[model samples]
Each structure stands twice: as structure tokens, then as C-alpha cells.
Target: MATDELPDRIAEIFNGSTIFITGASGFVGKALIEKLLRLTNLRKIYLLLREKKGKAPVDRMQDIFNNVLYDKIKSLKPHALSKCTAIQGDVSQINLGISQEDREKLKNEVDFIFHSAATTRFDDTLKYAVIMNTRGTMYMLRLAEECKKLKLFVHVSTAYAFPREKILYEKAYEPIADPQQVLSSLNWIKDEAMQEMQDKILGDIPNAYTFSKSLAEALVYEKAGKIPVIIGRPAVASFKLTSSEFINHELATEHVRPSPFAMMDCRLPVFVTFCLLRYPQLKCLSLCLRMHIEIY
Candidate 1:
């Protein structure tokens, strides 16, 4: 019998490490949790979940496991999931809205931190965007700095964070605005005025989310000294996800939306996924989700 090779990147980082993750409920976040549980023997995954809809964080974590994403893991390493614990907190609040005890615990015990919690809403107001994307980053940075044995702080940003440049490369640039200054100005700038000036403020950037992400990138880049920080910009594109395609093992590589490309299949015999990292001459940035698919 032959077996597919495990993704070494997953094991090299997550194996036997206590990971503190912020966005466990998001699409990418859930997939990450599944991959970690499936591919490696991790120590623990601390999900920073806030009590919402009158439900506890642990209860919500259970609902997350209920998703089909965890089906295989639920069967294979049934006890592997026992490593995951819920840390009640919100990213949009002070100190990620975590209790002092939990914060100190993470600072002491956690080895890896993944911050994927951000509002990707294009139409969100500048006020809210700054708080969620920009300020939320600062809060995570503060916590990352305090970790005694933190190895890496992986921040999930967007390729569109720098929309001004057509040929975007991997490098940190000067921030549009100081995050601290943006936080202070949020106190005084009325939402109405902010809306009016939003276009001018973002300049070539399209939405408030990207603009705030650009600012967040700068904040993360500056703190590279305290911790080994990586700003992961996923140019993940949306597919024409038809109902039938979702069930059957079929993939369409049609140039959907002229930018991002996503291929879907029922299963992958061997997970060999390749990413299309080319954005030649288009204003539309693509989000590529390379998934393992079985050819029927």
C-alpha cells in the first residue's frame, strides 16, 4: 500500500506546539484547524472565541467540529481534537478581549500564533474597519510580543492590501498611516466625515478593509524584531460554486472574474496543489484556493 506524503510545512511548525488562533470560525481558519489536526500531532489549539448569540465559546467550538471539514479528523485522530481548547475573547476589543489569566497563559505556554481574524467586508465603515483590521492587529501584536517562546506570528492579510501597485511583490513598505495615530484619530473623526473622506484616504486602494489591512501590515512588519512575523497575503479567489459542482467531483478552470482561480474536486488521492501566483496586467486581484481533488 502506498500513502500520500504529508505536508512537511504543517508538521515542522505545528507539531507538539500550543497554537493560539484568532479566527477559528472563518472559512480559511476552519480549514487550517482541520489540516493541523489531520497532518500532525499538535499539542493544543487555543481558539480565541467570543460568546455570541448567547452561546459559550466551547459550545461554538463544538459546532465548528460538527462542520464537514472535520469529518475525517473526527474519525482518524478522534482524541487529537481533545487538544483544542477555547479561550473566550474577541479580537475587536482591548487585548483581544481576553482575560488576564488566559493572556498570561498564552504568553507562557503558546509557541505559535496565527492571526486570521479580520473583517473582509468591502462596505464596512472606516471606523469599524480600522478597529477590526488595524486595531485588532495591534492587539495581536501586543500579545505576540509578550509570548516568552513565540516562534512565529502569521498574519493573514490580502494580496489586495497594496492595490496601488499592479505588480505586487513580497515586501513590507511604509505604512499609509500610523496605527496608533489611526486609533487616536478614530476617537475624533466622525463616521460621516470619515465616509466622505474615505476615497481620498484610501487613495488607489478599493475598500476600507484593504486600506486597513495595509496599515495592519505595517504594524506587523515593525514588530518583526520582537517576534518572527510573517504577513501571509492569500490572494484567494471565489469560485462559481454551483450546487452540483459542490457535491460531484468536477472542476472548472474557466477564467472566472478575470483574476483569482479556485479548483474543486470530490477528493484528492495525493494532495499536490499548485498555486497560480501571477497577476500580470489587471486591476482585479485573484484569490486562489488550490484544493486536492479526485478525478473521476
Candidate 2:
């Protein structure tokens, strides 16, 4: 469908549903929230946020809402504020770090879940990547399993999960190694030692990002048979074009890639990931994911 038709179509899907969004502060997350508010009569949107540099989630959300792109949405829906609910938590924790009461509330009220939280830094350490990208996914899955009324669970993976693969495909691939195993074995190792062992663990994988992300995909497959699950994979450089010289750079997993795409855990799935979530029952959503992976 054309971009102009997407909002109206999406609006129809989420007419009265409540949604829980992770990575709501990131670029795509912000866009997703804006589009929903601008186009749909979404009942509520719960944002999963972690306290950052002493800033609160409400403050952070306000900053995003005050952005210029949201102006149309704000004006179109004067009560847009009522649709946004900020839930303080980290995706890396159990139950997304939400309190027991909040977890119960979400399980009861939320109809959709969008797992877009991931660290997108190229040089991120193995420990950090595994925790946020791999384990964080595990946590989200667990949370979704607990939700009594979940319609769909959308996990943002990457298209470059195989950073070294030149020509990719639409099908999903399994990880060379188990993510949890790698994480567990590295638990006792020192940071420096872990860094040094990165090559050994990754084998032919290009970086820790793709390696862990591959494992995250495996996690979804492992869990999907139990619920309705779909994965989306978006090719590299799906967003605004930079300069020509930077075009290839933006197309690959290189410098200038946003944090959301830079890190592992997120795969490059397709846009349909959101559609499955619109199904209105407990379902698993994954998109092979998207990012800019360069080819020589």
C-alpha cells in the first residue's frame, strides 16, 4: 500500500486497542507512536522506559511529543496525551522491569506489544549486547507469555543479522551457537577476557551484533510454535538518505547507523510485523529486521 493509505489502514486495525511499545524513545519507535496517534483511535499506548541520566520517562516522552513531527498528531487529537502511558522499566529485565502491579495491569489491559528496544552501537561490548539484545528478548517473550490478552508480540530484528552475508534472502536462519549458552559461559569471564574471546565465540560471524541477533531469532522460533508469531526483516538504510558517499555507508552496518539498528537483538524483519500484532489476540511477531549492511 502507498504511504498515504497506510495510516488509514492502520487506524482501522488499532481502532480501540491498547498497545505496549518498547524503544518508544528511539527514532522508529517515535515514528510508530506518532503514526498511531495521528491515524488511529488507539485506546492507550504504554511505553517501556528506563531511567536515563536522571531524566524521567514522562519528561522524555514529553520531549518526543513536543517534536515537530508530532505537531499534526497533537493538533488532530487534542487528547493525545491521554493515549500515552509511560511505564518505567528496562527491556533487559524480567517482566521488563515493571512492578508486579504494573505487570498485572499490562497483562490485563494491553492488546499489543512492540519490542523495538535494542542497543545499536557498533562497538558495543559482548556483555552489553547479550544483555540488551539477546536476554532482553528473552525477558520480553516471558512477559508476553504472561499477558492474558496479548493480541500480538512484535519483535524488531534486523535484516543484517548475517552481517557478513552478501546476498540475503527472505527466509530466516538459525544461529551458529546458542545465545544463552554463549552468555552463560561468558558470565565468569572478565571483561577483557570476554572481549578477547569475541572472535572465538563469533566464529565466522562479522560482529557480536549479528551473532547475538541470530540467536534472538532462534529464540523466537523456539517460542513461536506456542503462539501466533511473525518476524520482519528490513534491508539496510531504510530511512532518510544521507549523502551519496554515505549512501553505501548507511546501507551497511557501519558508522552513522542509529543505536536501534547498530546493536544486536533487533533483526531486519518486514513492515508486516505490525500487521500481525493488529490481530487482537496473543501472537508472536518478528521481522527478519532491517538495517544498512554494506556489500563490497
Relative to the true structure, how large is the alpha-carbon lDDT of every model? 0.72, 0.70
* Residue-wise C-alpha lDDT for candidate 1, range 84-114, written one tens digit per residue: 9999999899878899999899999988787
Cα lDDT for residue 107, candidate 2: 84
Task: Compose the digit string of candidate 2's lDDT tens values, residues 82-168.
Answer: 789889899777556888888888889987777878887767887778888888888888888888877667777787776665766
Q: Clashes in each model (backbone N, CA, C under 3 Å)?
A: 7, 50
lDDT of 1: 0.72
Q: Candidate 1: deviation at residue 276, Å?
A: 21
Which candidate wins on lDDT?
Answer: 1
Q: How far is each candidate from the true structure, as Cα RMSD in Å?
A: 7.6, 7.1
Q: List the residue pairs that clash in candidate 1.
A: 235-287, 236-287, 236-288, 237-287, 237-288, 260-286, 267-294
Q: In model 2, how many backbone clashes occur?
A: 50
Candidate 1 Cα RMSD (Å): 7.6
Give all TM-scores, in the order shown: 0.79, 0.79
